[model samples]
Target: MAAAARASARARPLAHPNPGVAALLVKDGCVIARGWTQEGGRPHAEAVALAGLGDGGAEGATLYVTLEPCAHQSARGPACTDLVIAAGPARVVIGQLDPDPRTAGEGAERIRRAGIAVTVLDDANARASLSGYFTRAEFSRPHVTLKLAMSLDGCIAMADGSSQWITGEAARAHVHAQRARHDAILVGGATWRADKPRLDVRLDGLEARSPVRVLLSRGVAPDGVRVINRPSQIGDLEGVQYLYVEGGAVAAASFLAEDLVDELHIYRAPILIGEGRRGLADIGLTNLADAHGRWRASEQRQLGSDTFSAYLRSR
Candidate 1:
């Protein structure tokens, strides 16, 4: 189920309006086939996996799926629940329940009605794969990751405001990789004017993966970037599943103030710029204890001379 969920994330921004799903069919203690949701969200994960079976793949195999196979019929495609029933899997292990009102628990219910055993796993990692969809459904905004490249002491730049190369080459490359996956990259007007950042992905063969560039500013719009005057307008960005907020402190803080940030990606170089701008502006926490359970780190690692970590906001 974990592997199936991981595979689902590959669909990303293209899978807008639908959660990318993945499916794996196993029998005799071996995987018969595995597949993920395709581009444009067609040929759903279950269909792909079912088609991959050479012979006798689903008769008694167990199906592991990232999401409950959709139960509601749609003109878009046949209901996944129908397909799974036809395939006759012996059992199904689901990573998470589909949140769609039309299909929520019906997929599993239908499978059980067919005498196929069903199990739902308690897995946080699997749930994270569809965070974008959940964020949009629950918050009416894209899943936002506030990314900061700062000094070990929490400074983003020198007091003079030059912030080039806070993290090393490896960390920069990783950031580029993130850009390739997200649907949009956003920054404040100050960062835009000072950096002239070509928020495009530069990785080989993925140059086209450059996300839509957005500027969070009330000032003059920069050439070639979509401009939103206020943070609240972020919810109006159509089809943006994942929004990467690359920042100057003010823009980063604005999202935090609105409690719109879903996650945090911090890259800390092993250096200090004690007098520089901080990574974020004050978020108006009246008491230190007020911020205790807002976020929890989910990942930490080393990137050359930089320490990188990711934090997801608690529900």
Candidate 2:
């Protein structure tokens, strides 16, 4: 179970919209097959593992899957539950149950009905690995994370939009790490025009994991830039598991208005920019009370002269 869970973690930031799931078939202390959720939602984890099985490899084998095989059928393929049953694995160990209304516990139930011994291990590691996927499946929305770098007074840039190097090297490096963990990074057209950021992860020894660069422009974005006009555009990204909203005020306001932000990462520098650009765009919350209980702080840390805090949406 631990090995399977670790493998699943590797697929994070890569699989989005689709659950980052990994599966392994082990029998008699030897590994038989291994697979993870592939791109574009085709060849699900179960199917990939089963494909590795040659000559009916599932017979008398134990299948370890990260999440309960999906029970619902879609245009992409048949229900994963049916595939597992037909493959005929002797026993199935699931990390967590699917929470989507169409599946919920149905996938596991189907496997049991097929006479395959099934076990659901709700361990902390497994649960954490699938957190983003389960959040989306249960809530019908993307797992959102807001990334902001500001001065002590909460200014993001200068009054004339000269916002560069607000944080130190350490803080900037940390931001790249955050990018590496997400499937996509989004910014508004205003920011794109002003900064022209590469928006790709750049830590040494780490593969250049570039989150799909997205421009939140209502119309055509700048030349050579990837753009999405509406909130609905997110659904088309397919397997984006984690979305990072890097903002200029207007773009942040748009997402907030849509109630699309799921998490927040705020980095505060030691200096203040009293007459600089505002920290955040107007989100149009009725009042501070209206914002109450919508989010919970998840983490807080200090790096050099900067402070980083993370918040998860309460809902």
Candidate 3:
């Protein structure tokens, strides 16, 4: 389980819209093969690790996987259960059972019925790594995270809407990293018209994975943009496992009103823009007390001249 967990960390930033998973094949207490889910969701962890084993692969080896092996068929490939069964690992250690309706506990049952030992380790690390995927599956919607960068006074932009560079380069880079972990990145129609931003990951050595650009406009979006007029419209997106809502005030309020937000990321610059745009528009939160326990702080960090904080919705 530890080896599987360690391998899973590498899949973190690339696993949006799909669960990050890792696998390792060990024989005689010596590590022999390891693999993680590659970008574009192909060459799954189990397939990669099993392929590395060659002929002697699973005869006397133990397979450690971050999630239960998949049992359903898809256009992309065959079921992982079939692969594991063919390889015939001596034992299997799984971090968590898959929650997708097609697999659920069937993957584990198939493995155990095949005369292989199966062990499940329910721990904090596994839960944290697969949180977004699990949350989306259980809730039947993308795990939503609202991201905002604002002044200490809670203003997002100036009165004239001349907002530029609220946080330093380091903070902006950090925001891009966050974008890489989500399937879609959204912004208000106003922000879309004003900034004309390109929501693509720009980290070096990391192939640019552009989050599907979502505009919160009721009408048709620009020449080459994706727009969602209603919150329910997100259902049309095929494999959107995670959704990042980065916005101006109006767009933030829209999602909040629909009770669609699942997490919040706020970057507070150490300055103030008093009478300008607020971080959030009126989402009909009756009072500060009404919003008290909706979110729990999950992370906090300082990036150059900015303070970045992340809050997860309390379930």
Error of 3 at 252 (Å): 1.2
Q: Rank the candidates by TM-score, best first.
A: 1, 3, 2
The TM-score between candidate 2 and the true structure equals: 0.74
Off by over 4 Å in 3: 1-6, 9-18, 26-31, 57-61, 73-75, 205-207
How far residue 200's Cα lies from its native spot in candidate 1, in Å, is 1.3
Model 2 steric clash total? 5
For this target, which candidate reaches the highest TM-score against the unseen true structure? 1
Ten-residue region with minimum lDDT total, candidate 1: 11-20
Compute the lDDT of residue 66 as modeled in candidate 1: 83
The estimated TM-scores of all candidates read 0.94, 0.74, 0.88
Candidate 2 per-residue C-alpha lDDT over 221-286 given as tens digits, one digit per residue, 9 for 90 to 100: 666556888765675555666878889888887887888887889999998889999868778887
lDDT for every model? 0.87, 0.83, 0.83
> Residue pairs in steric clash, candidate 1?
none
**Model 1 shows how many backbone clashes?**
0
lDDT of 2 at 273: 86
* Per-residue accuracy of model 1 over 25-88 as CA lDDT, tens digit each: 9889898888878877888889999998755669889999988889988888999999998888
